[model samples]
Target: MTLIEEVKAIMQRSASDEYLNVMVPLLEDYVKAECNNTFRKNGKTVYPGGVKIFIAKACEHNLTVSGVSSKRLGTVSYSYDLDFPDSLRRLLNPYRRVRFHAF
Candidate 1:
């Protein structure tokens, strides 16, 4: 399945197509930035399986906490710092590129 279709399935029809079209690519770009753009090399691009899932999950998280820095639900409260999530960062560790400089 395509990325949008896969993400839509996981979201369970929560987001609109227009929103997904905009957010999915933005999130994918975020992932590529976090991983140092290794997915693109020498005019060829590739994405590992996990990357796709990560993008979908990130989209969900963004939709869940689109606005407001903090929210309260009954006795429960949540805060959004808007930083890249640590959990998502873990997923990208395997793909992160490291460069070494010559001495």
Candidate 2:
């Protein structure tokens, strides 16, 4: 199966086609930036290794897109669900260019 198809599957019908397109790219771009575009190493791309991370981030991105689907958060606002899942946070935090600093 294609990479995008994999991402779409992990999304589990939460995101629409258009939103999925947007989010999947964000995951890719974020990875590229974090890895200094070196997703390829030893003649291989990390894309395979990072599939789960990509899907998690894409679902997180869908939350940001206001595409809450059948998640069943609540009425009027799903402000609570706006927080991205901790798994995505754990995956992306290390890859982030800027590290958090505690005061």
Candidate 3:
């Protein structure tokens, strides 16, 4: 399965709010550190782009429809926005690119 799929599986398997609360930050940190390492090695940033796509996909996969539209759960929203890139603002339009938000 893809990384996005793996993350979704992890979320689905979480037992409680505490599990989600704990895992999300570790996931964000892993993604950010991975992105930084990739940027350093390749001289360009691609991991964050991958992370953005993963988050968007994850939201779509897991979000619930409250009424006419869908809204992500708090954990999903938090993970989606964590450490998003700002430089590729033009390429990734429409979606809000969050830099980082620590809880």
Candidate 4:
């Protein structure tokens, strides 16, 4: 299986919302690394390695596997919506404030 597939499999097996919470950062890091490699080779300003696509796919899979709706909170924000399971809601609070600005 490919690395992405492996990551998907690992995500599929996790139960705790905390685990999903932790996985997001790791997946983002993976995507960023791939994007950087592509940018380095192609000299492109945009991420040409489909990092966003991968992130979306991984997030979708995570939601489906966990039975939650992972909605985009903003351009660079995401959160588990109201449809998430109660167990998860208690563990994953999406209402926490976060700050980000685009220059």
Give the TM-scores of the predictions, in the order they appear.
Answer: 0.71, 0.50, 0.27, 0.28
Instruction: Give each model's whole-structure lDDT.
Output: 0.77, 0.59, 0.43, 0.45
Model 2 earns a TM-score of 0.50
Candidate 3 global CA lDDT score: 0.43
- Which prediction has the highest lDDT against the true structure? 1
Total clashing pairs in model 4: 0
Model 1, position 16, has a per-residue lDDT of 85
Model 2 lDDT per residue over 1-103, tens place: 6556677666545666777677677767766775445456689755644555555565656556454544444555433445555665566544445546899
Residue pairs in collision within model 1: none
> In model 2, what is the error at residue 47, expressed in angstroms?
0.6
lDDT measured at residue 46 in model 3 versus the true structure, 0 to 100 = 34
Regions of candidate 2 where Cα sits further than 4 Å from its true position: 41-46, 64-86, 92-103
Candidates' RMSD to native: 4.3, 6.3, 14.4, 13.7
Per-residue lDDT value at 36 in model 4? 34
Ranking by TM-score: 1, 2, 4, 3
Please give the range of 10 consecutive residues that has the lowest summed lDDT in model 2: 71-80
Reference-based lDDT, residue 39, model 3: 31
> Which is the winner by TM-score between candidate 2 and candidate 3?
2
In model 3, which residue pairs have backbone atoms overlapping below 3 Å? none
Which regions in candidate 1 have their CA more than 4 angstroms from the true location?
A: 41-44, 66-79, 101-103
Candidate 3 segments exceeding 4 Å error: 1-10, 37-103
Residue range 1-103, candidate 3, lDDT tens digits: 4444445564433334454445545555554554433333457433445554544333333343322233467655422333334543233343233457699
